[model samples]
Target: MPTPSEPVDEFDATSSTAADPVLPAGYSMRLLDWADLPAVHALENRLFPLDAWPLSFFEEELAQAVPEPDGGTRDYRVITGPVPGSASGTTATGTAVTGTAVTGTAVIDADRDAGAGEAADVVLGYCGLMCVPPLADVQTIAVAPEAEGHGLGTAMLLWMVAEAARRRATDLLLEVRADNPRAQRLYERHGFEHIHTRAGYYPGDASAQGAGGGRVDALIMRRRLVG
Candidate 1:
């Protein structure tokens, strides 16, 4: 609704003592798994209908999470909060799922563990990063409408920054829509600076743009992690 943009946040990668973001109580973050694909895909379509990536896209990205001879190239995380009054977790397809929580972190796998109790977890936000040595790219990041205003966005961003640094990346890059100043400011606050603009990079609806369907420009921003 705020003019679709590839949103991002700031991080002081140069500082060794940068504080990790603290999530609000009752919410937990963990590595994304196959069971989350349906929910994530639904959220993606809801948040960015015009340019939402297909379910297959997410599958491919997750597949790269596996360790290769050259090390894994993808990292994805999901934040989930309890669903009030729900007896059990359900995937997007309405199938029930059981998860195990360990020290404030929950692991949701595709297979159900009998007698795991009735605690339903809902995906509130998700983020992905691609790190390949000298460069890192933010693939996607989004938070549910109801989860906005909290620190979810910033927390996820900090995770990406830390992961990129761990992979020894020298720079981080992302694209934001030119019309979304809020997202731009967030990135700038974390050390990202606009370097280029891709003209008419985002597609717009024909009804909104009149006949030809005007496109939106994308601002390319980068944060240098090292000299």
Candidate 2:
């Protein structure tokens, strides 16, 4: 397995085209930075209210993206785009900003380019991977509601697959709610196979109980990256 300091021939951290999908116009993907936590946490609650991860979970994950001498084992990425209804990828304050890809050790100041009145670029999607040589896991992945249907999810999933392969992981694993057939299909289309099922793996949204909300089973899936 290649450490963070080691370069993987197939996926260069600094190369925009290496293992990165061409995103929709006006949208960009980059390494997840500390400054992105607030937006990521908020989006987590909105997207998975029933089992949203706390802010601390994300903080801990980001810390692992940069391995120490003992070894760190994680990769995370975030996709950003203009605020909806904003003009030409500019924020409400009419300031245009683009997210530049950064390495694990890089720091991005989300507000550096914006004036006091300007809003930071919107995080449209985010995904994470945890790799330890032979095995890699898709820690989390989500696309904002407004950003769905534009292939952002597919793009992120591809990044996970490529990153795991580059890290010499033989297989990649992830769990999805059984009720979320849409996501299941996306994984399936990307060559993931259903391998196991965990009963009642996800807590139900009490607020949505009137519409058939209850504990949901989790479908464990895996994709082979190398033999």
CA RMSD per model (angstroms): 9.8, 9.5
lDDT of 2 by residue, 128-209 (tens): 8899989989998877654555667777887788888777789989988776767777778778999999887777667777
CA-lDDT, candidates in order:
0.66, 0.68
Residue 174 displacement (Å), model 2: 0.4
Q: Estimate the TM-score of every prediction.
A: 0.74, 0.75
Question: lDDT of model 1 at residue 51?
Answer: 74
**Candidate 1 structure quality by residue, lDDT tens digits, 1-227:** 12122233344556642334467666777889999999898777656656778899999999998653446789888988753233345322211110100001123322242123335467878888888889999887776654555667667776787778767789988888776666777778777899999888877665778765588788888888877
> Could you tell me the lDDT of residue 145 within candidate 2?
54
Off by over 4 Å in 1: 1-20, 68-70, 83-120, 211-213
Clashes of 1: 2
Worst 10 residues of 2 by lDDT: 95-104
Clashes of each: 2, 1
